[model samples]
Target: MNLNQYIDHTKLGPTVSLAQIDQLIAEAIKYQFKSVCVSPVWVKYAKEKLASTNVLVCTVVGFPHGTSTTKVKIYETKEAVKDGADEIDMVVHVADVKAQNKKAISKEIKGIVKAAAGRTVKVIIETAYLEKKEITSVSKLAIKAGAHFVKTSTGYAPSGANVTDVKLMKKVVGDAGEIKASGGIRSMEDAKAMIEAGATRLGTSSGVSLMEGEKINGNTTY
Candidate 1:
C-alpha cells in the first residue's frame, strides 16, 4: 500500500508556530502526502507553499469542541475556503447527537457543506465522546447531509480512532461517504488496521514516522 497517499499530513495544535507549519509543509512535499491539515490561520500560507505540488491544503472548523453555532461554523468554512483551503474537517455538535436532534445536526452539516462550495468536507464526530449507536447515527446524518467523509476524532479527546469505530462507521457510510481515521494512530500497524477497517484517509501528525517505520511514544494531536 502507498500509505503516504492516504495521509493528510496533519498538525493542528493550538500553539503551533509558523516555523512548525513550514516544517509540516516541507515534510508533506518531501513525502508527497495527500494534504496538509492545518489550522485556519495558516490556510493561506500553507496553500501558497503547496501551490506547485499535488498536496492539498485542509483546515478545521468548530475544531476540538463542536460547540460553535452553525452560523459560526459556516462563516469559518467560507473564510477557510476563501483562504484557499482545499478540504475542510469539521466537528459535529455532540450535544445534538446526544439529544437525538437529527434535524439540528442535519441543518448544521448541510450548512457547512453548502458553505464549503464543493470542497471536500469531512465531518469529525469525535467518537471518543459518543456511544456506538450514536456514532452510527451521526455517520448516517453526515452522509445524508452531503458530507464527503465521516471522521473518527479530533485528536484532542481523551482517546482517538480505533479499528472498531472505523468498521462501524464504514458500515453506516457504505459507499455514500468515505472514512477518515484520525488521532492515536501512531504506527504502521495502526494505519494498516484503520485501512483494513475501511478508512480511505488518515489524519495524523505521525505520517512521516509511520512512513519511516518508526513508532514514537507520546500523545499525537492531529
Candidate 2:
C-alpha cells in the first residue's frame, strides 16, 4: 500500500506555528501525501505553498467540538473554501446525534456541504462520545446529507479511531461515501488496519513518522 496517498498530513493543534505549517507543506510535497489538513487560519498559506504540488488543502470547521450553530459552521465552510481550502472537515453536533434529532443533524451537515460548494466535505462524527448505534445513525445521516466522507474522531476526545468503529462506519456508508480514520493512529499497523476495514483517507499528525516506518509509543492528538 502506498501510505502517502492515504494520508491527510495534519497539524491542527491550537498552537501550531507558521514554521510548522511550512514544515508540514514541505513534508507533504516531499512525500507526496494526499493533502495537508490545517486550521482555517492557515488554509490560504498551505494552499499557496502547495499550489504547484498535487497535495490538496484541507481545513476544519467546528473543530474539536461540534456545538457551533449551523449558520456558523456554514460560514466557516464558505470562508475556508474562499481561502483556497480544497476540502472541509467539519465536526457533527454530537448532541443532535445523541438526541436522535436527525433533522438537525442532517440540516447542519447539508448546510456545510452547500457552503463548501463543490469541494469535498468530510463529516467528523467524533466516535469516542457515541454509542455504536449512534455512530451508525450519524454515518447514515452524513451520507444522506451529502458528505463526501465520514471521519472517526477529532483527536480531542477520550479515544480515536478503532478498527471496529471503522468497520461499522464502512458498513453504514458502503458505496455511498468514503471513510477517514483519524486520531491516535501512530503506527503502520494501525494505518493498515483502518484501510483494511475500509478507510480511504487518514488524518494524523504522525504521517512523516509513519512514512519513516517508526511506530510511536504514546497517544497522539491528531
Candidate 3:
C-alpha cells in the first residue's frame, strides 16, 4: 500500500505556530499526504496553503476531551467546514457512553454530521477511556448516526492507538465505516500494524520521519 496516502499528516499542539504549519504543509505537499490535520484555528490557513494541492484540510472539534456539549460541537463542525476543512474529526462524549446514554451519544454525532454538511466526519471514540464493549457500542452508534469514519484516539489520552483496539474497532465498524488509527503510531512497524489490522487512515505528526523511514521515540504528535 501507499503509506503516504493513508497518512493524515497532523499537528494539533496547543501552541502550533504558522511557521510549523508552513513546514507541515510543505512536507505534506512534498510527500503527497492524504491530508493535513490541524486545529480549527489553522484550518483556513492550511486550506489556502494547499489550495492548489490534492491534500485535504482536516481539523478537530472538541479535541482531546469529548466533554463538549452537542450544540457546541455542531457549531464547531459548521465553522470548521466553513473554514474550508474537508474533514472534521470530532471527539464523542465518553461520559454518555459511561452513563449508557446511547441516545445522547447518537444525537451528538448526528448533530455534528448534519453540521458538517457534505464534508466527511470522523468520530473519535477515545478508546482509552472506554471499556472494550463500550468501544464496540460507540463504534456502532457512530456509524448509525452517520459518521463516515471511526477513529481510535486523540493522542492526548493516557494511551493511544493499539493494534488490538484497532482490530476490535474494525470488527465493530466492519463495512459500515472506515477506521482511522491515531494516537501512538510512531514507527513504520506501528503504521503497518494498524493498516494490517484494517485501518484505512492514520493520524500522526511524524509523517516526515515515517516517510524517511526513521524510528521516533515518542508518539507525541497528534
| Candidate 1: worst-modelled 10 consecutive residues by lDDT | 213-222
In model 3, the runs with Cα more than 4 Å from the true position are none
The candidates, ranked best first by lDDT, are 1, 2, 3
Candidate 3 or 2, higher lDDT: 2
Candidate of highest lDDT: 1
Per-residue lDDT for 1-222 in model 3, tens only? 799999999998778899999999999999999999999999999999999999999999988788878899899999999899999999988888888899898889889999999899999989999899999899998999999999999988898898998999999889989999998787899899999999999999999888887888864656
Q: Could you report the Cα RMSD, in angstroms, for every candidate shown?
A: 0.7, 0.7, 0.9
Query: After superposition, which runs of candidate 1 have C-alpha atoms over 4 Å from their true positions?
Result: none
lDDT of 2 at 179: 99
Relative to the true structure, candidate 1 reaches a TM of: 0.98
Q: How close to the true structure is residue 13 of candidate 1, measured as C-alpha lDDT?
A: 74
lDDT for each candidate structure: 0.94, 0.94, 0.91
Clash count per candidate: 0, 0, 0
The TM-score values for the models, in the order shown, are 0.98, 0.98, 0.98
Tens digit of per-residue lDDT, candidate 2, span 43-86: 99888888899999999999879888889999999999999999
Lowest lDDT 10-mer window, candidate 3? 213-222
